[model samples]
Target: MTTLHLEHASHAHIHGPACGHTQVPHGDHVDYAHDGHLHREHGGHWDECEPDGHAPHEGHDHRHGEGCGHESVLHGDHVDYLHDGHRHAPHDGHWDDH
Candidate 1:
């Protein structure tokens, strides 16, 4: 749970259900998908939301790699694959929801 102090959106840009961006639930907060990253409201600005820890996505068999047919999203130091409207990242030996 950290706020990207250097990266933020315009204070005038309010994000909501009709903001046109996808809303992603992150732990106790909600993040908005903008560009290729997730943003959350912090104070008067939008901070980049990078969730720590991984929640294993059970029943996942398909391995996501270089040509796995899923859209790759650069999440912090790792890459996450988008599958069925959710993001998946490789964990210890399985895929974790990012």
Candidate 2:
């Protein structure tokens, strides 16, 4: 299991999987240039991007288990939710184009 060290303004050294990268949901329009570091906001949370020393993967899947249901964010693809053996696509409100 590879770990990623995220350097942020108020905090640093957040360890997680290499391929499991998540951007804090902050409305829309992500700004990468802040404090001379890669920054991402999601759900009102901010995190620093992986530096050049980190390895980049072609695909990234960040999923978490919540009770009997599961939530996931798939890169380069659509978001999906699996609950009780049934799969559901994200609602129209989840995307801006809709």
RMSD of each: 4.5, 13.8
Which prediction has the highest lDDT against the true structure? 1
> Lowest summed lDDT over 10 consecutive residues: which window, candidate 2?
89-98
Error of 1 at 78 (Å): 1.2
Scored by lDDT, model 2 comes in at 0.36
TM-score (all chains, Cα) for each model: 0.57, 0.25
* Residue-by-residue lDDT tens digits, candidate 1, 1-98: 33445557464678899998767766567777777677888777788776566568999999999998976766666777778766787878999886
Please list the C-alpha lDDT of all candidates, in the order they appear: 0.74, 0.36
Residue range with the least summed lDDT across 10 consecutive positions in model 1: 1-10
Residues 1-98 of candidate 2 have per-residue lDDT tens digits of 12134535564434233423432232343323233333554444556543233232222233333452454433235543433332233433331211
